[model samples]
Target: MPAVCAVLAGAAACSGVPAGFERPEQPVPTPEGYVDASDPQPISEIAWRYGPAPWRTDAMGDPRIEAEMAGIPYAIEFYGCDQGQGCTDLRFVTRADLRDSDDPDKPASRQARVWQANRWNLERRFGKVSAGEEPGELILEMNATLAGGVTRQNLDAWFDWWRVALTEFQDFTAR
Candidate 1:
């Protein structure tokens, strides 16, 4: 889905930055996707740098589901909404210790990068971003969420939107 305005509704009435949204002293939300590179980063850094990774975004679950798409050397992650709400725990690693596999840009990696960029970009103007996890391969273990944003039967839709990006990555690396 195309990116939407970060401004939220009913969240407040203030305008132009929204009255600081609480002092900076107060810690930000976990999924806010904020972290200091100097201080060890998490796995979801991808969300921060990439901004809401995932091609086919969907809404389902208490914390929502996120999918990723990758074309061999290129990767992309699609951020999803859990139970009609956006997902929390947006974690990814900006500087990951990935293996020298035939295709370094896997779907998850691509998603992570995009997700990280997104979080970083949004947090700059909106607020602190929430992120976690160390850069590594996430076991393909999830059930497909059925209609109405139910994660009961979660599925991996990460690679769906990454085809184009991955192709670009591959094309560049191929040279």
Candidate 2:
């Protein structure tokens, strides 16, 4: 049967449509000019939203965005990508040097830094914190998964959480 349509209040309304012939609903709301949540976002999309960040390719050729938040330098490292498909995952990484409280000129011992990281991890469950590769350095990291796609609004919320995590870590290390 042909779909019956009507004009109501200058708006088009349809009815009597077959079960499989109805028009699809509008997509979920996303930020202006950003892709819908169901769409796989390319690196350029991310950089467009958060950029002016310096872009550099890693040894494996995946792109990374160098940026900072709350005075802490960090990198948005992309993973699981190719020339065809965009990256499926990304991580925000920041490393801060730790100093011994008793001796301002000295670096904190690895055991001491690990213990502090453990305490913070147990108390707060947002981002993961650990000892960095270098002595007396602590690493803070957060991950985002794009394999299933992510909404730009949700991504903004994640960045908000990252700022909070970084601030808390800075205060914790200072104390």
Candidate 3:
């Protein structure tokens, strides 16, 4: 019994790092030429608090547009926005399209605005989801044109169509 008890005590002591015997903390990554003690918790907090919600344009754009906000792409409201006028206004349009930047006068600025506006459209779509519903999964099937030369009239027409088509998705909640 004494021998068994001694072995058990030895095993227990070595089973894991005992009290206060911790390894020195490792340093976090820092930018080149940066040298200052910093806390990462605030950075993470800022991300979850200030960053765009996962259902934002980039996230929703992933995997497909149809089934916007839960499997649907909101491309239904982008009819007639062709290459000439630029597909900047449409979120479902690929990043490559925006990178073309033909309108050199304000290319970067225009692309940023285009991305932001498309995000708003995505937000509107995601907002329509019901309680405990996916935010980007509904696929919308429509014969629409994304060609450039989209005038205000064309934009308005599509808006009206989508307002009706997406009426059911209005006021959706994030699951």
Best by TM-score: 2
Could you give candidate 3's per-residue lDDT for residues 1-175 as a string of tens digits? 9999999999988898877766435423344432211222221222233222132222323212222322333432222222222222232211111222445443334435445345545765322221111222223222334222234445445444544444433322111
Report the C-alpha lDDT of model 1 over 1-175, residue by residue, as the tens digit: 2233334532344443656454465333332233311111232233233344432322432221242333132222223333434332222211223232456564335455445446444543322222224453322111121222312112122222233333333342233
Candidate 3: regions farther than 4 A off? 1-137, 141-143, 169-175
Poorest 10 consecutive residues of model 2 by lDDT? 1-10
Error of 2 at 119 (Å): 0.6
| Model 3 score (lDDT) | 0.33
Model 1 misplaced stretches (Cα beyond 4 Å): 1-17, 20-159
Question: Total backbone clashes of model 3?
Answer: 41
Please give the distance, in angstroms, between residue 66's alpha carbon in candidate 2 and its true position after superposition.
Answer: 0.5
* Predicted candidate 2 versus true structure: per-residue lDDT over 35-100, tens digit per residue: 322333344355445444566667777777777665666777776677423565678777878988
What shift in Å separates residue 157 of candidate 2 from its native position after superposition?
A: 1.0
By lDDT, the better pick of 1 and 2 is: 2
How far off is residue 61 in model 3, in Å? 11
C-alpha TM-scores of all predictions: 0.21, 0.68, 0.23
